[model samples]
Target: MTIRDVATRAGVSPATVSRVFSQPETVAPGTRQRVLTAAEELRYAPNPVARSLARRRTGNLGIVVPDIANSFSAMIIKAAQQEARHAEYALFVTASEELVDDEERQARALAPQVDGLLLTSPQASDACLRELADIVPVVVTNRLLDSVPAVLTESAQATGHAVEHLHALGHREVAYLAGPDGYSNQSRTSGLQAACARLGLEPVVLGPFPARFSSGVRAADLVLAAGVTAVVAFNDDIAAGLLTRFADRGVRVPEQISVVGHDDTALAEMVTPRLTTVHIPAAAAGATATQLLIRYVRGDDSGVRRYELPSELIVRGSTGPVTARST
Candidate 1:
């Protein structure tokens, strides 16, 4: 059903229905109730595209991410959804699956239907990002953009700090289990490399890993053979995988090999040997990005501002001083 149909059933003009959304105070309370009741009974979901064309406001925010399965992405989506609802807006989320073409397609497809777009380290090139910003306001999360504002969680820097933590545990060799090839992965790799360089330690960068349990399972052997006392993973999923794989291999955690992961997701502390990881402020970043996009939509040029949130290391049972001998 359409809003027009709802309007007819409510015996009100389409304008009145629109007013019920944008300016409910302008409509009589009785009439607003009728329209709402009709809309609910009819299951009428508004055509956001039509609304955008008519009012120049979609009342929606488009969120594009590389992978929805990532816990970090899930947290951001949750927070952004809450902030959007609180501001009387809607949230639309799409995934790119780490494909540049798919990222571009999702961005273009959702742009016109949303008042603004939030990208989580989009795979598109700088030129593509610039074009996207030209078409609509874009807020990049955990990614850098020259033409658009961004809310960054400093994942790279956090990764660096994680390395330092591992190094302080007397680990001379450290390995990184990385996510897929994207701007975010590059940042993490660079951060690890920088930290390793400063410590005069060798950094073993492995796999554009799938950022999943199975991928971590596959990476276990490589991690064990690398002779690294501590291994930092792409995220909590991989860290959990690492811990499970090590257990299956009869290698005790921390005592045999220290493991660390990024994104202090709920799963981080749930396992037997709780994961040590970098805590990305995913929720706060999401809420802040939504607020910035809303301001931009409201004609506040000041919304075009970069906000950098802090990240911290959450040390857990998974990491410790280097073991004297392999388990």
Candidate 2:
């Protein structure tokens, strides 16, 4: 039976019935028992998880990611869970596997079950994202939206610094191995272009490879073909892949080719030659997005808000002064 039917039998408003199932602590003991008894007699299952988005304090939040397998995404998810726990709110997380359509579908399914949503590295178009914001409170990270609130890394300047580091070491030409053509890729591209123009260095761009270690391994052959002394990877996963392939081909890092990575994840250090990378504050961004989402849920503010966290390049053994370029 529907919520209204249960409410009528319990002699209470539909909202009260919802609160009884979703937030029983708010209901009087006697009233809660009466509602429970009625639901039992009617054989009604509230399916609380799916119905948690009722118009009351449901104490639940939702989060969506482009790809859950990515280490950067994992870091954000873990941090968000901690923040949600501290706030005494439950979090529901799902991924789109980097598909824009699947991301939209999953988000739409989740919208009705939580008080607010945290979106990380969303691949959805602006129109789709705006539509979702109209349906539920939305806070995004790793991307900037014209209308929706966003928390992102301001990395263009830092990206320039990465290029400058190469230039300082006497490398006049650099290549970039990219991931998807999403907003993140665009941001890096903008930074690279600006840096090259300002420093008068030549820049070469390689494939928009999948953001995976295997993909990077495949891209390693292409990097050697580009004939640049240095290369910047989209992320640490791909950066590690490049190292693996370069080693197999007998291409010594720094001495033959220098490499830079983004999102300085744990893999940066685990590799043979430590990677020089751009550090994105994933944990802080997750916590901050969660805080904003809850604030919106509690009616603190409904207007759009924005946050741009900093990114820095970490130098390591992966890069060095220009050496003889490996053929």
Candidate 3:
């Protein structure tokens, strides 16, 4: 029931029991094992609040995402939670509703209660993030800010490959359905532009649309108006919505308009024709970010600031050779 009880059963002093629980590596392995065994038998568990107050650590990590409902964010959160648990840390997660102000507010609020923070695709400005980092150890995913540790996926490379694929299939012009304004969206746009120039293809830049299914539905008209043979969407949710609109309008995919999407989310496969998309390692990014945060929180200063994950293009049923249109 208490450290004293555990120590009595393990035939050790109370200080030894405390050392075994607080810094097990400092205690002898045999002694540590005996203390643990006795503690288990006696049903003795350290009080987290008392330990936190004594050590000045909450034993909790904070995570903030733009949208908890998004599949991409969900994957990241789940993996991060698993990694935190493995490191014996609890996670406090918050959603920012895709707003920069909300993200900053959440970070400020969580900074006092958690040992560190993990921010996934944060929309907050660099100044805001830098200030937040000053208040607490922060690890970022999907955004690159100076002096902040980050885990970034290769968005530009994936977009370039998608463009190459479309070009090979004789798509002379492609319309890009843009996502919300952020570092990730900026990277995707840059990739699309670079690829278009490299491939000698015309690029039709569309809306700074919300990364939602409804936006995709609305984008269908703009896409058709652009007269591009192929369309590259910001993410799978938008791509799925476009597919629905195309189907309703009797426009055959691949035959009339080939489509490509990013983030290879579950919606990519759930659509009638599986989407050709760029696969971003959401889970890996999350796990890696958690590890980096844990390391930083523990005062491991190896000057490791960034971890870049690769993204790949996946060909599926949604895209094919461009067809000739009747004038």
Return the candidate ranking by lDDT, descending: 3, 2, 1
Tens-place lDDT digits, model 1, residues 1-327: 766898899999988998887667889999999999998999876666665556678778899987798787898899999989998888999998778899999999999888888988777888989988898988887777667888877777778888898888888888899897765677778888988888898888889887777788899999998887889898888888888899999999899899988889888979869888888888898899988888887779753499888878888899888767742
How many clashes in each candidate? 0, 0, 0
Model 3 local distance difference test score: 0.90
Which model, 1 or 3, shows the larger TM-score?
Answer: 3
Q: Estimate the lDDT of model 1.
A: 0.85
| Candidate with best TM-score | 3
- How much does each candidate deviate from the true structure in C-alpha RMSD? 5.6, 5.8, 3.2
Worst 10 residues of 3 by lDDT: 318-327
TM-score of 2: 0.83
Worst 10 residues of 1 by lDDT: 46-55
Candidate 2 lDDT at 291 equals 89
Judge candidate 1 at residue 26 and give its lDDT. 85
After the best TM-score superposition of candidate 1, give how far the Cα of residue 224 lies from its true spot, in angstroms: 1.4
Cα RMSD (Å) between model 3 and the true structure?
3.2
